[model samples]
Target: MSKWTEIRDGMVSALDVSDVVESAKDQLITDLTGDGMDALSTVADKFITQVQVQAESEQGWCMVRDKFVLPLMINGILWAVKLVLAKSTPATATQPEAPTGDSQQ
Candidate 1:
């Protein structure tokens, strides 16, 4: 496989693992009470913040794509997936509403 393919696969795997880990942490918090829940929440928050920082880093984007465009595209795809799975009704097709007032030049 190509290097890019390998990198993509690795990233997906990492994301999956992160999801699982977060779930497990959540479960632990649910199963515990008081201090345990607070501790787990603190750790989870730190982990999430670290991941976000890494994801938004300039070097992180450049290491994969010379430009940051690819990451934005990937983010868009993930957003679409969430929209597809969400419980709300799918958006209805509608005509664009014309300007209610006079159009600006």
Candidate 2:
């Protein structure tokens, strides 16, 4: 894809990351309603707006337009990243284990 917008469009499909956006939205709503959260509810509202703005095709997340090298939707992006990291080593994340050798041949 020659255009940045095309790459952005294709990446969502190629990487199958569309669900991540939905997941983030759900998480935001959860945070908005849930108690004992570290931050205020209004932060979630701002993040939700950023997620919507980034998800829009017309917006398409451009640096020139949005002035972002880190992306305006970075909270959602970071949420997905944190999700991936959390899932990456579930066993180890929850419980400590001895550093062992590979099980497979």
TM-score of each: 0.26, 0.23
Shift in Å, residue 41, candidate 1: 0.1
Per-residue alpha-carbon lDDT of model 1 for 17-49, expressed as tens digits?
545665565444344444544565566556545
Q: Over the full model, what C-alpha lDDT does candidate 2 score relative to the true structure?
A: 0.54
Pairs that collide in candidate 2 are none
**TM-score of structure candidate 1:** 0.26
Model 2: lDDT of residue 67: 38
**Candidate RMSDs in order:** 19.3, 18.1
| Candidate 2: residue 13 lDDT (0-100) | 84
